[model samples]
Target: MRLRVCGICIQNERILLINHSLYGKDTFFWSPPGGGVQFGETATEALEREFLEETGLRVKVGKLLFINEHIEAPLHAVEMFFQIDSFEGTLKTGEDPELSAEGQVIEQVQFLSWDELTQFAPNQLHRIFSMIGSLDGVFHLQNYIPGQNSGLEK
Candidate 1:
């Protein structure tokens, strides 16, 4: 299992997300910027490093918002989602150091609004975003996801 720390950076009702075609040219997964937490590194440290590495933005990890468990065969991950206290620097698409140049998967990086998010099928978004009623509904995502399968990896 992987312990991944993801950051939630919301501003003006838009959320920052990374578009990754990890499966293939036609398949994609849009999720917050984050990755595995290396040994000896704190979750906050991991989030900061991940945001910079994947979004070109330096961010301060804030309060914990959600703890999600994804236990699929090859993709089990216990993800910790934290609010971004602050951020700086230009936002740009970045590379995943864990993958090789020829295996790059990240395709786009941008802030998406609720309307923009609704255009895609729920499976395309991060699990937390799959059922958000509105941009403000994000604030109600408790530390725990109530239903068992409502928010697992897709």
Candidate 2:
């Protein structure tokens, strides 16, 4: 299984998200800004690097907010989501090194308000995003055992 790190940055009542379209342009998945943890790197370091790579921002990673497992045949991943304490830099869409020039999955990167998020289907967004209303509510680890339905499609 691959290990990934995600950063949660809520500013001005908006959440930072990247439009992930790995499957295709029609299947845009809105998710937190993050990517795989590289070899010999800590989760925090990976997250900082991912933010810079995907959002063009230098961020200070905070406490772990959630631990989620995504299993879909050959695409299994263990993702760790953390709170972003602070950041400095202009925000812009960035690229994923893992993808080829023509295979980049990130289409857009921006801060989306809760009202804007609700406009999409639940499955289109990360499940943990549902708890954004309360930081305390999002500060828990969510483990996924294979085959056990957790009510979260993603």
Candidate 3:
């Protein structure tokens, strides 16, 4: 199983998201900016690196917010999402070093408001995205198990 780290950054009521289409043009998934942790790197360090690589932003990683288990056949990932304490630099689309220019699937990176997110089909977004507006200070650590229906499946 791959261990992944994701950073959550909310500003002006908009949340940062990376648009990815992993399964041809029909399947799109929107999630926070983050990636697999490299060897000998702490989760926080990996998150910082990923944010820089995917969003072109230098961010300070904060407390852990949620732990997610994603198991869908050959792809099993344990993902940790943390709140970004602070950030610097202007927002721009960043590239993943692991993929070639033509192989990259990241289409866009931008801050999306809660209302905008609701327009997407439920299955297209991260499970936690629905609760984004209600999230206040200090969210308790939560767990999302695989196979649980989000009721947004298309």
Candidate 4:
């Protein structure tokens, strides 16, 4: 199993997300602007690089948020999700080529409020969303299968 790390940047009740095309299918999934941790680089360092490379913004790494163990076929990865605060530069789009592991092109880089995010595809990583509401310090997400439903708060 490999280890990965990402950062969740939340500001003004909205979170920063990137639109990605996975496996040739255009899925507007929600994910924090972060990437895998390098061999020797710390999570903060990797996040800093990833944020800049993906969103063209500099971020100040904050507290650790969630830890997800994803078993998506041959790829079994343990992900460390963190909270990031402070950044520079106006958010833009398309940091790199679309749909690359190195990092997907920032097709859309906008802040979506929790309420507004419900309008998007359901099962779009709602564990993190729930965590936000419940204030669950850390989470362990497993067997995540995306589906259709309004993942909004009642």
The order of the candidates by lDDT, greatest first, is: 1, 2, 3, 4
Q: Order the candidates by TM-score, highest first.
A: 1, 3, 2, 4
lDDT of 1 by residue, 1-154 (tens): 7899988899888989999997798988889889999999999999999999999999988999888887655567788889998999999999999889999899999999989988988778877877578877776787756434433565
lDDT of 1: 0.86
Query: Which candidate do you rate higher for TM-score, 1 or 4?
Result: 1
Evaluate model 4: give its TM-score.
Answer: 0.73
Clashing pairs in 2: none
Give a tens-digit lDDT track for model 3, residues 9-65: 988877899998766666788999999999999999999999998888999999888
| Global Cα lDDT for candidate 4 | 0.65
* Cα lDDT tens digits for candidate 2, 16-91: 8999997688898999999888899999999999999999999999988667777666567888888999999999
Worst 10 residues of 2 by lDDT: 141-150
Pairs that collide in candidate 3 are none
Model 4, position 69: C-alpha lDDT score: 62
- Clashes within 3 Å, all models in order: 0, 0, 0, 0
**1 versus 3: better TM-score goes to:** 1
| lDDT per model vs. reference | 0.86, 0.82, 0.82, 0.65
On lDDT, the candidate that comes out on top is 1
